[model samples]
Target: MLMRKTAALLLLSLPLALARPMSTLAQAPVQYNVAFPNAVHHEARVTATFRELPAGPLQVRMARSSPGRYALHEFAKNVYDVAATDSRGRALTITRPDPSGWAVTGHDGTVTFTYTLFGDRTDGTYAGIDARHAHLNIPATLAYAEGLEQRPAQVQFAGLPAAWTVATQLQPDAAGTTYSAPNLQYLMDSPTSLGEQQVRTWQEGGRTIELKVLHEGTPAELDAYAAQTQKIVREAAAVFGGMPAFDFGRYTFVANYLPQTSSDGMEHRNSTSLTSRRPLRGPGAIDNLGTVAHEFFHAWNVERLRPQDLEPFNFSQANISSNLWFAEGFTQYYGELVLRRAGIYPTDTEYCQEALTGLVNAMMLSPGAARFSPVQMSQQAPFVDAAAAIDPNNRTNTYLSYYYIGAANALALDLELRARFKTDLDTYMRALWQQFGSQQQNYAPARPYTTPDLQRVLGEVARDTAFAGQFFRQHIYGHQQPDYPALLAPAGLLVRPARPNKASLATRLSFNAADSTATLGTTTSGSPLYVAGLDREDVVLRFDGQRLVGSKAFEELLSTHRPGDVVQLEVRTRTGLQTVPVTLTEEPALEVVTYEAAGRPISKAQKKFRAAWLSSKVR
Candidate 1:
């Protein structure tokens, strides 16, 4: 009797197991057809069809956040005229569930959802469409079904002009009109550009590196830009010891340097979106390359040397991470450093004055750096990274960009390693790439790293656990700044006051010609203005008993005064009029100048150090 009972249970379970595979096999790839019927008004029609869905309401949504960005964009605001129908061509009952998405019931296992998207800004985070081209940042353009994120997706671009072509990181079908992604994550990270673009390709380390530029520049200019870009690529690769094993055996740079585009460079796993209003010639040409060097370096850092906090990036809301200082900051340091290595900046003084000075000043002079550690500053990215707000913020007093903070840290760490440990940042980065970044699995990093992991790697690279612990404690976890003047001495660089003789209020003032008064902007927390009972919107009518008549009047007064001078000001606050005595101080700004430029002697040892630090590493 027991045997018979077991046999009966087995027979019933067999049918359930058989039905599961049948159900999965029936699920079809999600299909999207994008058409630009009203391109002139920056509108496109997109239809997303999800087939063989489970028995329930289909939840469809537009992503709220994009890859490479940490803010909530609410992409659904631009979507309108939404409607849905079932496979049998019968209208489904659609309900407004939330601001970001919709719910369609009675779907009959298949739902075709359609919507109109309006996009005008051309950058890495939003979509832009016009008579000339259509730039689509995937998360800002396509809507997806909730339960079908793991299924394959197909996108087809229809109704293009005769000269238009599509450029993206998505795997293309033989027809060249449609592209496919293994899953929704990959699809959303692939930004597409449709326009008349100049295409250039070269083979690097058994992989194809391509540049697609959409610009009004001549073909010869594009060719020249491409050559410079290739040099950047080679130097970047040498840092990591080689190129990343790019998915699809290729990496692409999708650039749009038209007047209609905004300035942005967003990184993805296998590609980068480079858009700017700056053209590819004259002064703008070199400026454009700076962005290229920055974004391409991200292909190895944030895109693959993955941050555990940012791993599997969320599209529904803002993603925060504590490691952006290393992720973005280190990349910032290398971005300009690579340019110097590529011989673009040529002279050590040029690199020091232009690049290093700004970085050191931002870290050393900012009240924000004094208040928060690098980790805390990185956590604030959601509120400050391209986020929109109406009310004024005291960020100037309380915040410094993680980009600057991290680069400063990178600069210090690199020097410490070279001076003390006899190693450099390149070796540390290569170790990180081998451990956490080189292995790719299912369109993401196989081993994403946490803050602790970063510390461990540094300790290993330096072969000194105690030194690494002290560095992280003081700089990364604590707010103590590195002694920059001491660290830069080995390179024969001097950190000095940019304007030693000039006196300043240390806050920006906007002059109102009608009232012949100057109104202050946000005051630094500990500056002379803040200490003297002045704040934003306070108006100064007179300086040193002289009427402030023009924008230059206050500047002229400052020029005549020394650092230790005192000035009396007639001011109008929100409460009433008053006179205040404020002591003037030397400008806190700092500059990095070569010792040779300062008429100081440089040893052969200093020259060797500077040469090794800035010279090209490419073989």
Candidate 2:
């Protein structure tokens, strides 16, 4: 009787499985065909077709947010002339439900959506199209059905010039003009550059690294740039023990250095989009390379060493993460350090002044650092990361960028680990990579980490739970800064006042050309300017009974005073004119310099430490 019951159940399941069939149950791939009919006018006509839809109204929409960006961008604003049709070429009824999406009915289980996208800006977040080239940032270019995110996608470029080619991380099909993505997340993250480009490729650690540059520079310049980029790539990989296994066994650098390109760098799973108006010569070259180093590091840090909060990135709203301090901040620290390690910054003084000094000063001087922890600052990214608003904000006093604060934290943590644990940040980073990033399930990280997980990993790396807990409690969750001077001592680096004898109000002032009076910009909290009740737009009419004539006069007055000196200031406030007492204080600006530059003898041990800290790890 039991055998008969089991046989009956098996016979029932077989018919259902055969009726549906595995192929019929699977969703068909979303298809996209893009044509640049009005390239000179910065317009690209795009068509996206969705098939095998469920029996309901098809909801199609443009993405309001993009990967690697924390803010919400209204991508639909640039899309217009939308029309939809069913599989039989019959026009479908489309209804507007919101600013970003359309609801279509009467589709025969398929809908073809078409639109004209006008894009004029060339950057990592937006699309740019012109006669010279078409730069497509996917979220800004494509629209998708709401329920079809899990379906694969295929995109093809049409009507390209004879000299033009495509460069993207999207896997190419047998047809050279078409590419494929596993899902909507991968499709949205892929940025494509189509135009005349110079291509260079090399093999590193048995994986291919390619650079495709769209610029007006000579081939020799591109050759030099590619060489420098290779060095940066190797140095970054050395920190992680090796490169992440790219999904397609390759990685790409899509660089646009044309005069019309905006300066931006965005990182993806297997590629980065680098755009700049700066040429690959003179000072601009180094600045461009700095961006390259920064974005390349993200392949390991943010793209894969995943923050749990940012995993499964959303498209309709801002994606907030509490770990940007580790994701972007640590990457920022490594971005500059990699250049130094790669010999781009050859001298200790140059590296200190150009990178380390600025990092420390930004963290130390900002009032935001005193008020918020690294995690708090990371949460504020949605409002500040390329976000646009007409209203003014008090960010100068209330917010410190996670990039600077995190980098400072990294520097201090690195020093502490070396001094106490017989280890360094590289070891900690490698540990994180192995635990969280190395095992790729598909397009995303298999083990995305949370804040507590970060602490646990640090504990493991340092072999001390107490130290890791304390470090996070004091710096990551609690608002406490590290002791910089103490941390730098072993490396023979000094953190000292940048301007020793100068007294300042520590507020920026803009002088009127018509008169000597100066209008103050935002006043730093706790500074003498703020203490005097002076704020933005308040004019300083008189200083110490002398008519404040110009910036020169104000500077001369400041030069005459010392810290602790008090002076009378007549200022025009928003309410009325008033007299106030302003006390002068030493400038809080700081600098990092070598001990030898400070006229001090360095011990051999310190020298060894500095060399080990700054030298390349590319063996």
What lDDT does each candidate get?
A: 0.87, 0.88
lDDT of model 1 at position 60: 96
Q: Model 1 — which ten-residue stretch has the worst lDDT?
A: 4-13
lDDT of 2 by residue, 1-619 (tens): 0011100000000101112335533767787767777777888888888888888899999999999999999899999999999999999999999999999999999999989999999999999988888788999998989877766666565556667778899876666546677778988999989888799999998889999999888999889989999999999999999988998899999989999999999999999999999999888999999999999999999999989999999999998999999999999999999999999998999999999999889888999998999999999999998999998789989999999999999999999998889999999999999999998775889899999999999999999999999999999998798999999999999999999978988887887767678898889999999988888889888788887777787788789899889989889999999999998889889999999999999999999989988999999
Model 2 clash count equals: 1
For model 2, name the residue pairs that clash: 516-549
Top candidate when judged by lDDT against the true structure: 2
What is the C-alpha lDDT profile of model 1 across 1-619, one tens digit per residue? 0011100000000111111345443557787777776777888888888877889999999999999899899999999998899988899999989999899999989898988899999999999987788898999999988877767665565556666777899876677656667777888999989888789999987889999999988999999999889889999999999999997899999999999999999999899999999999998888789999999999999999999999788899999999999999999999999999998888999999768998899899899998899999999989998999999999989999999999999999999999999999999999999999999887899999999899999999999999889999999998898899999999999999988888998888888888788999989987888999899899999888988788676788789998878899999999899999998889888999999999999999999999999999999
| TM-score of each model, paired residue for residue | 0.95, 0.94
